[model samples]
Target: MGDLNAKVGREYDGFQGTIGKFGIGVRNDNRRRLLELCGASGLSITNTYFNHKLEHKTTWVSPNGLVQNLIDYVIVNQKWKKSILDTRTFRGCRRVPSDHKLVISKIRIKIQANQEKRRTIKFDVDNLRNERVKQQYEVKVGGKFAALIGMENMDMDSEESWAILSSDTKDVATEVLGYKRINSKPWFSDEAKVLSEEQQRLRVQVDDKQDLEKKQQLKRRRNRKLRELSDRMKHDQNMFWKERATKVAVAMEIGESRAMFAAVRFLRNASQEKVWRGVHGMLDEDGNLVTDEMEKRNLFARYFERLLNVDTTRYWDKKKKKSIADLNEALEVQEEDISAKR
Candidate 1:
């Protein structure tokens, strides 16, 4: 279920193996099949899937066109009663580095208190708060994975994580969406191309006028040079990302080689090669990294330090913004206090 789109920005929806919004018909069939398997009742499978809540507020495509509505189709239709050990199943995002956002829930079924604990319907609430906002605030899936309303996360690592990981948990991408293949980069439309072209032409004209007298001087070549520099920086950043991928591969024990990380690593390297002199270089009289920039750099460094150690919690709050973890933490604390008083 590969795809081609003019729109791109890491917003994949639905499961793996599904074609997403682009493959409506294909997804329809998959949805139907799922319906049969689950025997879901009259529910709106169409117009389901929610858009991810990120800075871009990008709507995700349903990979296989799977009946995202059918995710918890059976349970919801039947109105099955259940108890989740971890109420966090319905929780959403934690703002990780993944291109697409992911939602998580524990769906074990719960019975009467005296009944034997069934490991049927639950899992821990692994998703942070931002993810929950994305999930709960999704476009009218018309109540899709919502069937999870009455389920539970059975206390057990009984099988594996809901989203399976490689041998090492590091490379653990959620396999639930059923994406059939790796997503390709999206291209801009004709309109976008024309705009980019016009911008380029204007930039060239600006350069010609500004540097007409001293065009030959390196410093006078600012605009033209900026373009060249940006391309290089982009390349380097991509390479850096690739290099990071290898670390994930290594942790996952998936044998992801250095070669695999080459492209992103190159981009990272290019981005790092900035030639800022003067104030841009942050020199106090002596030309050193500036105080503010240095602080920002330090923050970035410390942030990564925590991230590298998988201190996901700390890495998040440093944003000083609202997030799933923070919400959940507050929720938990609130509950604990209530319990203590009782």
Candidate 2:
């Protein structure tokens, strides 16, 4: 995403399929080059598709607070555009300390971890600093290790002993201290969760109603929900950063570089893009190219089926086969995280 500072504006006209109709203001001259670039690259302007509050539509606001424009955008390949659930400028974001508002887009994609190998769980090591927690962990680990050592008659090699010790330690740590998933995104609070559900309900009402006034009322309620969510997210983010800053400051004062670095990394907000192992064209056993997407997808499915050796005898009749098109089609549906639920 970049601040293009070019307004493609309200007129889609010839570029209807390339851009959405929800853009703000009139198209500037720069839009010609923008459109040309997008057309050549098969990219679509993602921000224009979603309907949001005016506060969210405007990415740049004047210092005097009078002028606001949608000069920034997030673009994605035309084929992958459906993966984008929502795109909007968040005016609530103030952590960046910038003139331009934060542009956020939520996209749904899957990244699979290797299932053949058992990956060790990363336990919350910092929790061991607490005296009670440290004692609990020590007790658990000591008990597990004692049990393993009790088998005096068992003959074990050095590798086996090391593996057992490592596994037992990890298991004990997980059981006692629990695990923390690495995440940097701002988390919504309970208030935001409730408001999101209310907004979803309001959206359904707006879609189902035929009366203009009722629909308008639902729209108003949804708008109010959006505002509340924004405020709530802003508050949550502010609190998180404030606490984080305090921790980092303390760490620095105490000369704990590791803690300071960890805090800094957490606040850095790393960019993670979903990398697809795309199948351009696959060759069958006969050395012929399988050019169709559906065929390529089936080839992958068959290959994995053989690799995993899934028993097809029982469920073959009832199981429905899926194509790449089906997966792409599913991406068209609007998506939300668990926080949107009641």
Candidate 3:
């Protein structure tokens, strides 16, 4: 839940399934948009569905205390509408000092655990670049193959023979090159974390203080701590990126294409993972939500199969023929020029 600032008032006329009659304030353009989005996505505004007091419903207030609106909301899928027990705003929370009150929702869900665990085996293949490791691996693998060849007289099927070969190769590789080690480092330093905690403490103190002067003083210190924390985070982030860039540059300079590409791919996959985390599921042709991984893969495969096999023969008319002829003519001329230069 967040400060959406969309005043979805108590009008449930056409959006009966998306909103409820208990919402506060007058409806605005943003409210209409939010309603339409929720309706289309099969989501319900949990904050509006539950009945609560005015103080518990309103999430934001003006500085002069003249205007109060229920702008923040907790939205959930209509399929899980019964799972959300309650939704309301907590105005008495002094831990965070903000004009917007804390909007929270209590949800009950049962998660099933997978019984089978899939483990991927990764070898230190990068070490194979070393001459000593390469020679050792080759010798071990060659000896295993020789032993397998000596077992040719046995009554073994093709599958068993193939399995034996594969197992022996893996055993040799494991003995020669070890497993790859993964090392993860945090981005922020201890100083930044300390400053963040101090800022939070000051905020709570400012909210609890009775005297205006003391509250103002606490607020100033909190703001200073916030600035310091922000600067420290920026410094840490820059240093992290700087180190990554240095590794990429060194790999490129040394002609290590594998290492350079691996670094680039890691950065790309990290960004893709961050973007994919927000995507919950996809809708099928019947407008039903598909959450299963295998089903989603099948849906994508079917969609692309139909899209890529479209009948485009009608578009291959005189203009396309002329374009192809021109391209071939240019290629012939280039081939002739190359021959002349040679």
lDDT over C-alpha atoms for residue 256 of model 2: 98
Per residue, candidate 2 scores C-alpha lDDT tens digits across 191-286 of 877988988988998999999998998899899989988777666655554576678889999999999999878656423422112312457767
TM-score of each: 0.18, 0.41, 0.34
Q: Candidate 1, after superposition: displacement of residue 164 in Å?
A: 32
RMSD of 2: 34.1
lDDT of each: 0.38, 0.79, 0.83
- lDDT string, candidate 1, 1-342, tens digits: 111122221223533222123222223334445434334342222112333323222223255633222122112323322321221112146356433333333457645567676654222223323574345434323232343332346453625434332222222212222123321222223444454565566566656765555544533445555565555444443444444544655645765456446544643554344422211222243433332445546756776877787757775676666576699899999999999999
Q: Name the regions of candidate 2 deviating beyond 4 angstroms.
A: 1-121, 130-132, 210-212, 268-342
Q: Residue-wise lDDT of candidate 3 within 126-198, one digit each (tens)?
A: 8999999999999999999999999999999999999999999889878999898653434567888899899
Model 2 collision count: 0
Among these predictions, the greatest lDDT belongs to 3
Q: Tell how far residue 296 is off in model 3, in angstroms.
A: 42
